[model samples]
Target: MIDKVVEVVSPERALRREAARRTLRVLNSGYGNHGASRTKKSLIGWNHKGGSPDDDITDNLEVLRQRSRDLYMGGPLATGALKTLRTNVVGYGLRVKPQIDADFLGMSDEEADEWERHVEREFQLWAEDCDAGRMLDFYEMQALVFLSMLMSGDVFCTMPMIERPGNPYALKIAVIEADRVCNPPGVTSPNIRGGIEVDQFGAPIAYYIAQKHPLDSKSMQNKWARVPVFGERTGRRNVLHLMEFERPGQRRGVPILAPVIESLKQLTRYSEAELMAAVVSGMFTVFITSKTPETPLGEAVPLEQQVDVTDENSYELGNGAIIALGEGEDVKEVNPARPNTAFDSFVMSMTRQIGAALEIPYEVLVKHFTASYSASRAALLEAWKMFRMRRSWLISKFCKPIYNEFLYEAVARGRINAPGFFDDPIIRAAYSNAEWYGPSQGQIDPLKEVNAAKIRVQEGFSTRAREATELTGSDFEMIVRQRTKEEKMMREGGLLTNASENQEVLGVPGVENEE
Candidate 1:
């Protein structure tokens, strides 16, 4: 029996060995151990003494070393392993099983089926490669790859602001990672291991860490300090600092200036901070005007007419005070400013120039300004009253129209079978102030009214039937007699007009009787 068993297994074993040999040869060709000595003394090392060592053990070790080297050298085996590892790791299922076994265990049938499918795929891949050791290596690779993916930015997570009544601009500025925690199922926890506790099932059940934005001193220096000073000038002792805060670098304690410069450049067009910086740097320019002398030396003309102080290039001669920027030698006048009769004419002129550049007409700008405290309070009260009144008015106007239409349609359709439609509180309130009214007593009982109308109609038709009988001509009688005869014949032949034989006969067609 032993001989037979060996004979059967020997060929299969030989085939597996041949396959492994071929795989090892392909791997080694790509990544050979270039520096290792080929001498037997160098190759032989530790040996197990329990039994005769397998001759193929050395070859297997060499193959494993070659595969590891291939991966290190950025070869195909390494790439394949990485790709497979990533897929397996990201695809692995982690779920929170409910504490109740009956509720949770059988509840995840669909999920369990999906997981089984995934495991089957892994098994299929493993089966294709006959080496069990490589299959184990793949599992280890899967775990490492999954950890890396979890650490990456694709996860959704959030951190709390460091400051109370936090700066809106700083809040907007903070960068958030993408692969952080999400409320959705299948996403991994974003917190550090010590911060959040996971259940025995590897599910995050609770968090211990305080939510906080990580702050770096160098990065947040401008935000924390009223002003940041870079270095003092030697002579004047003037402090200098960068216009904007620096961004934190990946390495702890380092700061990057590029983001600050980019942020400043982006702010230059619209932000007041950028404008203030420009003004302090003396990049801005301004203009001023001077008054002219009353009259020329030998002119008989009136002083006002004859007065000519400067040409349009300097300042237009007038009591008017204009200020503007200097365009080459010419003065380009801006809007005029209020001239206070204090200080030297030149200083006053400069003040007027500055005011002119910034000033806007009160009538034009006052409307754009928000109302101050007292005015705002008055406006708010007025708005509240108006809103309440308008709402009440709308309810009154619209509800009545809807109610009337509904009642009218319901009556016309013979669908309303009960009384008190008008007596409904909603309807009574809506119609309280109406000048014209519907029925003042009460709504008609619809079912009774319908029955009465139906009875009257029947009675009227019966009276008409009697009139027709009294005035019956030979032709009309002949027609009715003929129809009656035909109906009787049909009934006798087992073909009746009525659906069922048990049904009572209705009154004659096109005829009525008073009784």
Candidate 2:
């Protein structure tokens, strides 16, 4: 009975042990197995029971504990847990709270993993939005500011009263013209059949008008608020203005003008903005605009007052309004014009002085003259001639050395041929005068010059001879020693000492010893 009990108990214990081993293996296979030894070959140990209680499985336990720690400490599992928690706490539409992981023992690895994933998802969404151009960076904001200023049309104007009435739109219009010049593809002017030719001076007339009448709100609005539409069939000068048509409820039509006006406005605005920005940025070292004070144009008649129509008030001047005045106004114009003429005389004198200094022809200076004051052409010519005479006298007296230096440079560069080289009259005349001897007190002697030239040639030849002799001395000495040794050899070999025999050996007749 004791043996039977031992046998039954032994097999039963073995079966139980086998089952426990399999259970442990299954448990150790998954991610959550915390306490199982990873190195264990079989789950059973110490006589086929199960895990030994005395055997330290602390290393395996530590590994499992660490893995669990990682899961809760902001790993994927923790990230998922946080996401689920957020969803449950805040509902679907609520913004998910950012995952917060604290490295504490109380936090589970699953919670940390869920938190990490949640943060990652939020960042990814942000990156996608940025890539899709939904956000503006620093440069974009700057561009928007510039565009707003351009669209506002107030950028180029400085008039505090531009919000009022009766201002001329010339300056703004001219600015548009300049812009057309710069960007011709985008902006162009129309061809008027008999309109005035627009030169560079005329281009800026709009700006002058703006300066004269700053209170014109219509001008300001027209300058700034219009968009231009170009039609292929339509004339380039007559761009369609959006401001011309208005909806029934709208108060004002969009004001548009020639493309030239738009261009001028852009240029003026850009220049003004650059100037202002530079001033604000502390880039300007000098305040130049305030240096010159503007003088007012004296009492001038209004454009309407000068009109010649019998019914002056009743006459409406269309765009082609030119007033013809009686002889009385033309005579009165001469009195105010004298001061202008005197001013022009003073300017001409100054210009002639400057032209003399620069050695430029008076005609060249006259071509550059463009001023409100007018001077007589003959008077200007007379003044310029005197100026040139004075300059010649000054050159002869004070600048003789300078003249000599120029002559020397010309001679050294061989730009002027030596005398008698060519038979051309100009060439002969250039070398004929005593002045051709340059600034020297006396005439140059060709014979003495030739003697000096020969001395230079002889010196150069002697220098070459010395160099050649020094270079060949060692080689010549070596050749003489070799010849001596060969001659001795020939004599020892019982060769004849006659000139003919020696010539045959030395390969030269003169090299044989006559003795």
Candidate 3:
């Protein structure tokens, strides 16, 4: 073998190499305490699997939906939260206000106004009779749809055109509950998750809907209908899938109460326990014990004779009853200390947390406005922001699509006058531009609110119509017309006075800014 010459490293280089190795070890360990495994008591068993969005949500969806529904039915807080959202988000119904683009259509202001009025009236006519079951109008259906979404996480709506003698429009709304939409038994596909079939890009292609609810005992639940996302003939969407997506590729919705189901259940249990303790304390029964083998009080009845105490060795306390015990038997007065001093504080704290999760201020959520006027107004304004956001979402997803379809059919049927609606997409969209108005935010201090609204209009920050809509849910045009008629009557009868116009009625004056 050839002589091997060993190249020895310098002392400084060796120390640098050792230091580099130590750095690498530290880097390999992880970025922080949370990123590394630890045997500490708080983190020793924290082994939860991280999953894809669909894998995490779709897999656990059913149980989550069930628990959410159960909580809504049984828990007071859940019911209140659901009701609050339903009331604020879809109160009454979202009424449509046609906003046709007059400039593009080459129409005068008067022409546009007339056209809008005609369209609104026609839409209302169709909406009144649009329900498939012939029970609820479009406005009422909005509430049902909202409540269903709150309860079931999502709701599906189908608009099927069916001929009716009295109703001019054939469009009708048929609401499908969430339970009826599911993956059919014995059917499996890589593109399908939670009954929604998607393409390679994760866009929904179709939905599989069962003929009956899975839990319905009288019907066959396994039968499913595969509905394509768009109609094969007209290229219009056949089904309206109303769901708020929370993930990039999520195919389904999580229940509104999903995040706080456990909390709601625990709070409900605590409330019930407290109520029961208070009730028991109010019974106020007296028990007598004696060393001798006789009733301490002659009028007292024996515990065994009064109640069957064999179950768990428990005694029932009755109203105005004196219980007696035998010799050597003693009863200990275990005070429950009910009407717990901390009950309200604990409950308020828990409610605040839950309300935050639900995006509802505590005052609005519980309908308790005992706070100062500023505090209450702030709570309402905050709640209204969420309400407006949800309303916008509902309008974008549900209202606009339906109205577009309605406009299309109306134009095709020659009910609405439009020259190039079918020929051009731009014309169609311009014709379909509209605003949906729901319940107003409502006033806490009417005088202050009215003054603020007036200032907003005067500063060009808002329009009289918008202020009227937001403040009182009234149309500014209608208010002006009514006011003019009243003034004419007053002038005719010589009842017109400066005081009536200056002070205004109830210290709230009309907005003078033009729309």
Best by lDDT: 3
Q: How do these models rank on TM-score, best leading?
A: 3, 1, 2
Superposition error at 249 for model 1 (Å): 80
Question: Local distance difference test, per candidate?
Answer: 0.31, 0.33, 0.83
Candidate 2 vs candidate 3: the TM-score winner is 3
Per-residue error for 160 in candidate 2, Å, reads 62
Per-residue lDDT tens digits for candidate 2, residues 121-202, read 5333322222112254222322222222222211121111111133221111111211111111223343210111233433
Runs of candidate 1 exceeding 4 Å displacement? 1-378, 414-417, 420-515
Which segments of candidate 3 are over 4 A away from where they belong?
1-44, 285-318, 322-332, 497-515
Model 2, TM vs. native: 0.11
Ranking by lDDT: 3, 2, 1
Show pairs that collide, candidate 1.
153-179, 154-179, 155-178, 155-179, 155-180, 156-179, 156-180, 156-181, 157-180
Q: Worst ten-residue run, lDDT, model 2?
A: 434-443
Instruction: Kindly report which residue stretches of model 2 are placed more than 4 angstroms away from their true locations once superposed.
Output: 1-375, 398-401, 409-515
Error of 2 at 377 (Å): 2.7
Error of 3 at 289 (Å): 9.4
**TM-scores for all predictions:** 0.13, 0.11, 0.85
